[model samples]
Target chain A: MSKEKISSQEIIDLLSAQTDFTKRQSEDFLKAMFGIIEERLIAGETVKIKNLGTFKSQWNESRKSVNVQTGEEFVIPGFRKISFTPDSELKNLVNEPYAHLEAVVLDSNHEVTEVDDEDTEELEPLNILTEQALEIKGLLSEIQGIPLTKDESKIEAEATVEIEENNTAEIPLESIIQIDPSTENLFDKIQEKMHQKSEELSSLEVVEITKDESEIENSIIEIDDNIEPELIVAANNEESKIEAEEEIKINEEIKIQENDQTETKSNYTAPEISTSSNVYEEEKIENHYTENIIENNDKDEITSIASDVNRVSEANNLIDNSLDPVDYKIKRKSKWWLILIIILLAIILGLIATYFLSSATRCWVKYELFSDENKEKTANVKNNILNIFGLGDPEIAPKPAKIEQDSVAIQAVAEDSIKVDSIPVTQSKDTIVDVFNRPRVYDEFIGTEKFGQGNTLTNISKKYYGHKDFWVYIYEANKDKIKNPDNISVGTSIRIPKIDPRLIDLGNPICLKKAKELHDLYIEKK
Target chain B: MNHKELISAISSKLSISKNEVEQMLDTTISICTDQLKEGITIGFQSFGNFEVRKKEERLSVHPATQIRTLIPPKLVVNFKQSNVLKDKLNEI
Candidate 1:
């Protein structure tokens, strides 16, 4: 249990201990058993051992890969690999710990609903409201082509004004005056003053209209010079003061109504102005121009008045067109400002959302990496990332062994350093220095090789240790079996022990000197 | 070679009875399986090493239907050939 790898020698020892066979017999049997399997595998035949496993040689096709450090592309030549598939009985035995687990069928519909739920959770009510506002704005822009005509504005305004007037009329002024006698005098005085001002304003307006007509007639007579002055005087004299006063009162009431409507709905001012001007034009035509046209016997006066009425209508159209564009431009400018602000807000919100999302993912990655429960999962993810970067081996089975070995080596080095510090300085300085400098090789064996014809210790050493001079280490490892350095029996198995990498590093001069010293010592002993 | 031929080969090589060889092989396999189940790596020198590895749970999709299935985690027996055996095979 203390040893990680049970070597072939150990297995043979175990087998001999378990049965009545000798060690040599057990070793021979084990060797023969594996030999037949290897031979069959080499012949491209599958060997199935009952209750154990099936061994087969698989041919891997040549493939392309890139070197991680150099970033160079190279082809990995095709080769055969020995693959083993365990028997179902053995597989089940090995998987007994995880036998309760079963493959779960993932429902795609359930996963979609889960994702939608997460999205709904992330959306706040304020965000939904903003989204609705944006939709309504889009619809308004789409419907921008249809003009809101003045007639519709006037009708709407009139309806609202009439409602207000009816509500005010319902609050009877007579009842208010009766309820508060002191306010009654004030109301009567205000009414009397308002009547006097209205009458004065009406008389003045009539006088002004008469004077304006007389001036226009004189101007026409001067232009024609064929018309009688008596006709002009009679045409001017035909205007009645009573009709003019009535028209003035109607104009005043219309103005007051328009003022009230303007206060209630300020946005429709352009349309209201157009409607009011139209009413004024109709009044002038009916009260002054039409009467003058009938009263004058001369056709010239009638034609001139008709022309004047056309000019006034044209002026009103010009005013309406000019005012409508100004109001529209103001509205469009305000809408543009609102749109710009909303866009800015949306961009800010988007930035904030991205920041939070990125931070959440980062926290998740950290949790995955640090949490003990997810250690294996994170390792797999890291390996996948390394593979993507071409820095990891695609075969994952051997990685754990390599990493474990590396950790053991690092721990051994740390322990050796600590041991060096604990050793007393009173001992021989050179031996202490040697102990400190010596690289320690742990009890690990890579594999074994049989002593075949023409195979010397040096050849075996060179094959495994990468240096011909490192033969002494191999002889030292197999000193119990190999009695003499130069002589060895054929077919004797030798365990190729793993050595400390620092002890045989070719690039290190110290390592090379150590190997040379060991060679000299072995030679002198021989 | 098949199982019977393998038993005969080992019996002939070891100069033992077929039954003895078969019994010994079965004992050896049982011992090896027990060790492997305990998470110990059994290395046969130049031949190969047998160990148990844990295969993590993963989501796998079917190629034709694209149905994702969650494959549960399980312990698997894996065998990796030693470099010496690989070289020997290549030489052959």
Candidate 2:
């Protein structure tokens, strides 16, 4: 059998091979299933898989304990735990490989003791070597004992155990010491434990009143000599108190970070329970100190402790203002008002667009007729419609259509002679034509005659004006009927216009004499 | 809900065949086991986290039989719900 554990990728590959799914699809399916299971479990539901197993959860209550050696009591907080049990089918399948194998009876206890004896035999040389190692530890403790007590050696050993338990993979003491600064609160805890031990030692000292105080002071001086010269220099200066304050603040900050301890504890993953055991010691010591402080109700003692408490509080305030990092919550204003404004603007714009599109551009059909008379009739009909609507005539005035007499005669001669003759007609006169040419009303016709074949404006002019050169005037008067001045139909009556006297050449004596005679006749008539 | 209800619901939500959902669910158990064997923690945010805790070797006596057994250290899967989900449950 392959020793390699089945990874998610491997499962995906297997699923892809077995089912009609790609590796990615298999992965997604697995994720979705796991997500569902997690969701159900979180809702306090027991997940049961038929013929496989069932998964459920239980709560392990916190256990309270007291350590006899340190007289420390603490509680291990309660936590939720999950459990699983396989069904019979799955269990049978799992046990199938070992079914044929029988359990062999062995002297496990005897074998363990034998192994232990062999281990001790192998450790004999190391034990002898460690005898020399003890001397170094003895010297180290001797220096430490001046500041603390015999109990501290055991505490130091326990602290080392706690460090080893925090990270069993990395056993180096230097690495553990490096982590000490970060675990400054834990160090404060150690200090608190030392203080309690010191109290106990002091109480014991009270019994030995004969003991010389100078010897203790001398031992302290010796311990001071053993310390680094820089520390001694710092101890002698005023700045030392500030440094101590900063150190205390750092530990207080660590205490403030209790929330982060849970995540960090997971990172430790220590197999041994020594770290928690140390926590018990710290908790017990805290309770003990609180009790002691409460019992000592004397004013002098209270005042002394109160000063230290005040100083610590002042340091904490300084640290909180200068060093404490707080989370800043960024406020985000809602955009509903802006959105409403935009929507309103859009609605207004749409309304305006629609209004202009429909009302600004008016559609009307402007009909144009080929015949001028038909156009005039249509205009009259339109004007009648406007009158019904209580509106005046069109904004622009209409022009009257002038029909040629030839086309008028064609209709009168062919079908309406009686009607044409009955209508009052103007008499033809040369003098009338002359005055009509002056831009005055020319209601009197200059001349009217039936059009003949091969007749043009020149022929008509020769007949009406006594000169063919005056043909242009006739053409101008009848331009509506005569599309081309060169073409005039037979039997079509034509209207001749009056000639301008100033346009006539007086250089011809005969023509001038005729013009003068006409002028005299006109003046005599006047 | 029971297994059948669970299967039906998954089928409707995923819009897949019931067989497919069943296969995928079976695969989940194996995957969890594999991860647990490797000491890997699988976490689903706002829902729960799954991890394997190591139980140390110990000697235990059966209360009824009065026989002692040496229980070897073994890995076990642990699941803890996220606070968000826990709060959701508290409302009920």
Best of the candidates, TM-score? 1
Best by DockQ: 1
Q: Give candidate 2 regions above 4 Å deviation.
A: A1-18, A22-28, A57-82, A86-526, B31-57, B61-68, B72-92
**RMSD after CA superposition, every candidate:** 44.6, 51.9
Worst ten in a row by lDDT for model 2 chain B: B69-78
User: Tens digits of per-residue lDDT for model 2 on A1-526?
Assistant: 2223334566677677766778887777766665565567656778787754676655668999888799799887675544556555544444443334332222334323322242565356556667878998999877655434323433444444444443442544455556445444544543454344334433343322212222222223322221112222223442332232233233444433432332232222221111222223223323332332333334455455457557755654653343212101000111232333235434654554444333322210121234453354455445433432325333422111111232233232312111111111111111122233335333456777676765666677667666666565565566566665545667667776665543443333434444445445533553
- Scored on chain A only, each candidate's TM-score is 0.22, 0.19
Model 1 interface Cα RMSD in Å: 2.1
Listed in order, each prediction's TM-score against the native is 0.33, 0.25
Q: Write the per-residue lDDT of candidate 1 for residues B2-65, one digit (tens) a residue.
A: 6788999899887899998987788898899888888888999889999888887666888998
The Cα error of candidate 2 at residue A121, in Å, is 12
